[model samples]
Target: METIAFFNLKGGVGKTTSAVNIAWHAANEGIPTLLWDLDPQGAASWLLDSKAKSKAQPKKILNGKTPIGNLVKPTNYQHLDIIPADFSIRDLEQQLQLQSEQGQRNLIAKLIEPFSENYALIILDCPPSFSLLSEQIFDTADALYLPLIPTHLSLRTFEQTRDFFKKNKLKPKRLHAFFTMVDRRRSLHRLMLAHPPKMLKNGLPTPIPYAAVVERMGDHQAPLPAFDRNAHVSKAYASLWQDIKATLSDF
Candidate 1:
């Protein structure tokens, strides 16, 4: 299975929303998709209307006491399943550190390996932080999608992420960034969208516009397409999914 992770060191950039909508699009196309909510906040889980059976589930899975597959729950949409997360996932870093001194770093990769037989695509909705868990995600995912707002601070964060990868000898090419919450009324946003920096020349082409409909995902408890397929933000997400699929094809 091809694993894709939605991550950003900075939060509130539509990371979970993109992950959920993209997974929905893939599932709608008849591809078997699994979305694993790795964020402790459980926003993705909430959006999908899936919740963990118990608060201890994440810790148990991390400690190898519980089979990850057992926690997989089918979503309302066909061909889509989710491994929901809870607040307990916040302890993931601590659990990984206590596992094996040498192999702990690759624990996530090991955990995700067995799912290849069941899923065609696996999406990980990662937490917004640079921690041991983030390192494991970097090593495990085939591609990392970084969603950032069109702002100077967000650009700086993207550069910092690239530098971190380069300094650690990881493949920076794995990163594919796109703009989120873009408001054309703002000159800075418009300028960046029109002509991004050299580093973002290879970034995804579609930029998600700022819209109240996007925020309504929480109220609908579903993906953008499920609620309003013709909405501008929903259309943008559909186009973004197409771009992502084409990009992943090159890999």
Candidate 2:
């Protein structure tokens, strides 16, 4: 299975929203998809209306104490399942630190290996941090989708991610990025959309507009396309999924 992670060092950049939408779209396309909530906050889990039992934590699976498949919970959507996150993930770094260098690097890959036979795509909703957990994600994900705002600060974070990969001699199969919370009326947003950073490998041409619908995800507890498929935000996410599908030809 191909694993894709929605990650960013800076929080509040629409990472969880993007992940939920993309995973929903993937499942709508008949792909057996699993959305794995890796963030300690469990925002993605709540968004999909899925919950993990108190005893179900990623730490056990990573440490080889629990079977990955057994921890998965089916979501409300068809062809889509989820492995919800729990607060125990806050100590994930400490757990990884206790392992050997090889184990630290390969822990995530090993956890997901057994699920390859069941899922065609696995989407990871990651937390906002640059730590051992991020390193594990970098090693595990086939494609890294970075949700960035059209601002200088966001570009700086993107550069930091690239430098981290370069410094660590890591190369993910694909790196996709796109602007989120865009306002067409704003000059800066217009400028960034007109001329995106040349350094980025690929970017979705459509930008997810700043809309109340997108912000109301917590209240809706469902993906944008699930309730309001006609909304502009939903259309933007659709375009993004199409672009991503074309780029990830193997999908």
Candidate 3:
């Protein structure tokens, strides 16, 4: 499977929403998708209509007694499986760190190999941090999608991601940079988009518009298509999925 991680060091960038929606689109195309919720907040799980239990302990994906094959739960939507996030996943970074010291740096890769050929795509909803887990995601992902906002801090975070990769000396792969919740009316937003930050020149061709409909998905517990597929925001999301599929070359 093509393992893709949706990540942003900065939060509230619609990372989870994009992961879930894209997974849906991929499944709609007759490809089975596995959505792994790695965020401690469990927003992706919630969005998938899975109850995220904060107190429940999560199976150790790195070195747990039970293999991950049993953790897979079928989603309400066909061809979409989910690895629900429990708050205990917060400890994954620690476990990964220990595993790293023991010469197993590809903890995630090894943990993921079993399912690599089982699904067409694996969507990882990462936490908003540059922690050990995040590093693992960056290192192992076939593609990394960053949801950037039109703001100075967001740009800074994007720079940090690049610098981190540089420090690690990783060969570049499919890295996507796209603007999210973009407001065209705002002068700052327009300026950022018109000028086109250097990071984005080689990235996505479209910017996701700032639309209330997109935000309403959280409260409504549904994807944009469920509410109104022809809505402006829905169209933007569908188009974004199309572009991502082309970039990934497998959806």
Candidate 4:
């Protein structure tokens, strides 16, 4: 499976929404897709109408006490399954640290490897932070997709991600980025889009517009496309998914 993570060091950047929408699009294309919500907040799970509680603690899976297969739960959509997040995931970093010493972060990779061929794509909706758990995600993923706001601070965080990869000797394979919540009326937003940051290898061609329809995802409890396929934001996500698939081909 092509494992891609939607992540940002800073929160409120539309990471979870983008992950959910993109996974829907992938499944709609007849590709078996799995959305793994790694955020402790459980926003993705709730968005898919799944219960917020999970019987299996993600910590156990990370500690090698439970099988990763047991964590898989089918969502309402066809060919789309979710490994929902639980509150116990808040201790994921501590669990990893306790399981092994330094440089033994392959536990996540080992967990995911067995099921690599079972699905066409795996989307990880990661928590917002720079932590030990994030390091493990970097170890497990084939690509990292950062949903950033068009701002100077967001550019700084993107730089930090690049620096972390360099310091850890990780190849930035398929490192893709796109701007979320873009307000074209704002001069700063327009200027940032006009003069793209050098840190992004190939910026996604479409920017998710700042719209109330996007924010109403919580009320709909489904992907933007599922409710209104013709909505501007939904169409944007569909186009974004196409761009993402093309980038993943390079991997």
Where does the lowest 10-residue lDDT sum fall in candidate 4? 51-60
Candidate 4, residues 98-124: lDDT per residue as tens digits?
656765656667777767767889899
lDDT of 2: 0.85
Ten-residue segment with the worst summed lDDT in candidate 1?
Answer: 96-105
Clash pairs detected, candidate 3 = none
lDDT (0 to 1) per candidate = 0.88, 0.85, 0.80, 0.84
lDDT of 2 by residue, 1-251 (tens): 78989999999999999999999999999999999898988999999998887667566666788887878999999999998886376566667777745544566777788888999999999999988778888988888999999999998998888888878888733667789999989999999888887876566676889999986778889999878999998999998998778767576
Q: TM-score of the candidate numbered 2? A: 0.94
Q: Per-residue CA lDDT of candidate 3, range 1-251, in tens?
A: 78989999898998998898888877877788999898878888878788644443454444666677666777778898888885376467778888889887577777777897689888899998888788888888888989898899898988888878878986345568888899998999999988988766556767888887777778867667766788877777788888887777554
What C-alpha lDDT, on a 0 to 100 scale, does residue 73 get in candidate 4? 85
Model 4: lDDT equals 0.84
Looking at candidate 2, the ten consecutive residues that score lowest on lDDT are: 99-108
Task: Report the C-alpha lDDT of model 1 over 1-251, residue by residue, as the tens digit.
Answer: 78999999998898999999999999999999999999988999999999876644666676678777877889999999998985365476677776656554488888888898899999999999998788888878888999979999999999998899899988998899999999999999999998898988658999999999988999999999998999999999999999888767632
Off by over 4 Å in 2: 55-59, 101-105
In model 4, the Cα lDDT at residue 109 comes to: 70
Q: Which segments of model 1 are wrong by more than 4 Å?
A: 55-60, 103-105
